[model samples]
Target: MDETAHALGASRTLWELVGRRAGLTPDRPVLLQGDRTLTFGELRDGAERAAAGLYGMGVRPGSVVAWQLPTRIETVLLSFALARLGAVQSPVIPFYRDREVGFALRESRADFFAVPGTWRGHDHTAMAERLGARGVFEVYGTLPDGNPGVLPPPPADGTAVRWIYWTSGTTSDPKGVLHTDRSLIAGGSCLAHALQLTSDDVGSMAFPFAHIGGPDYLVMLLLYGFPAVLFEQFAMETALPEYRRHGVTVAGGSTAFYSMFLTEQRKVPGQRLVPTLRLLAGGGAPKPPEVYHAVVREMGVQLTHGYGMTEVPMITMGAPDDTAENLATTEGRPPAGMEIRIVDPEGKPLPAGADGEVRLRGEAVCQGYADPAHAADVFDADGFLITGDVGHLRETGHLVLTGRMKDIIIRKGENISAKEIEDLLHQHPAVADAAVIGLPDPERGERVCAVVERRPGTDDLTLTSMSAFLRGEGLSVHKLPEQLEVVDALPRNDALRKVLKYRLRELYG
Candidate 1:
């Protein structure tokens, strides 16, 4: 049988056939908060209503709708609502000041929108009022006066356009990753099996609802007849209680998020939450070494270090219970069914261990970017999604991320990769966070500099200390930074906590 039928037989796509199981375990909790609870049947009812509402508004399949929401119950409902109507979802990670939001709105060409009047203390409704679309639903406050009835009916086979994720742009032009019903069902099914998701598991999510991972979790949980728990913020204080309250079995967060959680527990390790958590994995960015060490030893949660892009999330993931060396040292073997290849600039596949641009081919890979022009530069001749990232596949089948092809820094005649320097600095315990950027230099043309965020209350990180640490690690004197700027925090895009290299270039350039 074909993949689509296979997925249906396996009961994937929670919004599709996935919800048929909803009535099977009606009384069982479908969603849970400290005091709030929604059974599987209840959530299904709300989803039907939301779908009906959007349908009533005339949204058809392939309609692009953007959602700017915090981690909340409504976000999940809105997502399934769009899915029920078979319209595409364009989720923007929250609180992007007016400029970023405006860019996403205009670039995505969104037709309908659902945002909070004000979310997390920002006036999203007021900001979005200018959008003036056919339908607007606000949750943090009010969506305004416009109210459409129910959503349109689900589209026919192969017609659903699910998501349009925005990626960091090159040359100041943002790209929107577009996926079809085929990809979402295929990808979600891939995750359902890969993460070992089942009806019994409940996930505690710290990522934003607008992000692929957040909604991915939501869909996966519902796909398997499981529940999703949300935390408004990723604070350990709040996350812990929610985990205990909701009986959370799986929890997700970025590696940097884990680092912050570790930082928060410096005073008392026993006070930390997330005790019953069975599966503890991370994605969005490479895991810092220290964060990996703590998860295994301190928190006792297995860490699955995942490497993926918005174009195709979870291309590779380090399995939990794998050696700490595997999770920390390399982004482990590709998850089941996903494929990875390293290619030269000309797109020829490279031998194992050769660092070249990483291209991914999988059922999960997106069809194209919303901007056709950007999509032109994103695919290989055979249709593999060119993920701009550079890495190598070891003979052992493990993938090690080297850096970005575009992040090459040229200092005088020396060509340096910023990721190399940043990876070196991350090994230092004093270095909680670090980013490297190339700055214009009259003499060298472009020289590399390091900006580091130290552990909170660590007053001992000095230029000399950092240099000595690098020297001890046998880093080349040439590779050593001429400057080390200490920062309280690194600028981060909403879902990804990776070093905002773009912000670094802007600041230093």
Candidate 2:
């Protein structure tokens, strides 16, 4: 390991890393949102106060606190405060509702739940109350504050679980994936090293603060001593000015983000969307080869996509110095300590260049899920986590994902379980059977397509009405089906009558 990597590896906890960075560059701006700026020193100070306040609220070390907030300065402070207090935190996506949020709170056994009062026309505080959430509190414009002297000493162990991230379950409920400070730090280290970033580079966070990528990105800034612009709600037009204003050198959330930037750049034909942007890097959804070519040719920027999931924030990332062919065709390469194994159905390792289930083991990998039943099924005998993703390692060590072992559709980097939507569709009176599949979409990377078999003598269901029905069922807007197709019956295997989603994709894709 290099000197920087060695130092990062030595970080015992996230709070320790933050303190080191603050001491190194006290006045360096670490976060920029609108007219507000938070330097490394200021971040430490504010978090200490917040930590004291949280301590006053009966949140002791190892207390389970859950928060559902947007990407704001206050959110960052609250997260860091939790870290400083050594509290186990579960962050829910701001868009999640009763179905997801309720499950998270119950599973995590959150002692306290923090929320924004009312945001984007939704009342999160009211929703928390409706769920009878314990210790519900609002944290929008201001967070709790108290004297730093009341705060307890920072956590010493990094291996203990401090984070619970949710993965959109293939079934009805989401899995609470467990992670520790060391795992998050290791994930960030892989990204920082792979991207070849420096303290001089300015970054942007367009994704949700509750997403796994949030901590992963924040660790990069803390490690490199750089600043990043925060977008509470990222719209291309509104975010463009901020990017230019901050002189962002690195920007992108996922394939969708790259497409959004390219769409804006194509509006005027030869003008760059953000002139200061040199590298567009992200990795939640699959990136088509064409998207890479388009971004480089039209936007005049280098595009580097990687492979990651909620369980592991980052596994493999395309470096800025990698060959164009490798960057375009593969999902880059895993860092030195990460072990990627391609195995057959029986868990036998496969040869290079052969497609199989992708299993990973590394310091960045999450230890397990909160539920023991779920944990028992995910990890193998060798301790490698079975990723449920089908991919192969090239002779050059690049990972090329082919498909998934589960029926999960990744639309714009968000995992939408096909089974969840299918179960809801089955509830509709006019639907006899339903199968949801992700079709290849250049703009979204994958668009959700629902194919249903109508009940006998019932009126045909339109896409608009189906969407409205899903909305009424409290499904997140992003998970709604973008396309609808009616058929007599869904293709199924003869033995168990299981819907063959791959066949649906083959027919509709």
Candidate 3:
């Protein structure tokens, strides 16, 4: 499968890849949603007609079109249609509200906007009108259609910037991240190669299709010639039936996803949750080693977690054949073309096993931010993307991330890794989730504070007990959380469910 993917990876643009895959397996199923299935041939033909329709609607080559839609078969067709027309697309998450949506529309200077009207009880069309977005249109149950003869030739250059992905923007306005067709293809190839998937295996996409991971996963399907179930809204109670019905083999989106599956498995101990599930794989946030071990032991499934960001979708990914220790501890090895370099604060190269910033230079990395001003400090003199993540590389070529550069907590002139404390806190049976942040303190430079969500039926989780538990786990005295606050649930984003540390800081500071 990897060899085939490598050969197919030679295609220049995404449209070419789509056409090639459709030619190879025209009758094979590509996407599965509810009772509807879309085949490879239908995808090619449908996208062409859709592209002609969009062209008829004034969407020509290089036209900027922004769409905010849910994960549906129509959404996939529209995206590929845009690809067929060589139009620049800015996909906003369906859950984004006025501030984020307005910012994206203004920043991308989108010529046209597509909305779903009223989805999940929200009036998206009304919101678009309120924002004064140009060329506003709704694509709920129907799409634009026209004769295919009117469309021009597809895009030939894959290197041109044709995608604009926004950062989470938890702290401020989101920056538009620029990506190309070749870069997205490289990222998906790296991920598909790492997962070791086959056409016989079934997959699932529980996350939003608007995310950068959307194209990453789509490319994987085209390369491997497999079908994946699409969940418009993901929840354990409602999603389990689909998993069982489709016999999903590969499932997961991030650490939260792994935990959700584990929580379900615990209800019926000693029995597989989704009898067909063989692997749980994802990346986007840190994975506590304990979570990995828990999934492997409790769910009886292999969990392969990778490291990725919007700027560079796939950095390092765990393989199925990796050692148990490495799989549980490290983020696996990078593929052939991806380069991982560790550097100190001064930008000097750091030796293996030394903690430093993780820098990347590879085909999968984005060209740069949409606004060049946001990219000034993003790249260093060596031209590697300066990822704000802090980690070290083992001699065995595995990367282990500790925490974020700005996430480090300093106390009395000593630096403390928040992840170190958070990881230990997760081990406590009473804690369901945790986030450690540095709070402002007058006496000390900064104080370590631990905000945690208590596990159900465990109400005795006080600060004193938490401190004693940490000390017993061999945590340093100074690194111990000075203040402890309990919340019903930790604040998280809609995508990946990554804990919003900045939100925690703002609330508890």
Which residue pairs show collisions in model 3? none
Stretches of candidate 3 exceeding 4 Å from the true structure: 169-171, 406-509
Q: Where does candidate 2 stray beyond 4 Å?
A: 1-6
Question: Candidate 2's residue-wise lDDT over 84-142, tens digit each?
Answer: 99999999999999889999999999999999999999999999999989999999899
TM-score to native of every candidate shown: 0.75, 0.98, 0.82
Ranked by lDDT, top first: 2, 3, 1
Q: Who wins the lDDT comparison?
A: 2
Q: What digit string (tens of lDDT, one per residue) describes model 3 on residues 136-251?
A: 98886778999999989999999999999887422335678899999999999999999999999899999889988999999999998899999988878999999999899999
Error in Å for residue 324 of model 2: 0.8
Is 2 or 3 the stronger prediction by lDDT? 2
lDDT of 1 by residue, 109-143 (tens): 78887777765566777778865543566765222
Residue 295 miss distance in model 1 (angstroms): 2.0
Q: Which residue window of length 10 is worst by lDDT in model 3?
A: 406-415
Q: Point out where model 1 deviates above 4 Å.
A: 1-14, 131-134, 141-153, 269-273, 408-509
Candidate 2 residue-wise lDDT at 111: 98
- lDDT, candidate 3, at 201: 86
Clash count for candidate 3 is 0
The local lDDT score (0 to 100) that residue 24 gets in candidate 3 is: 91
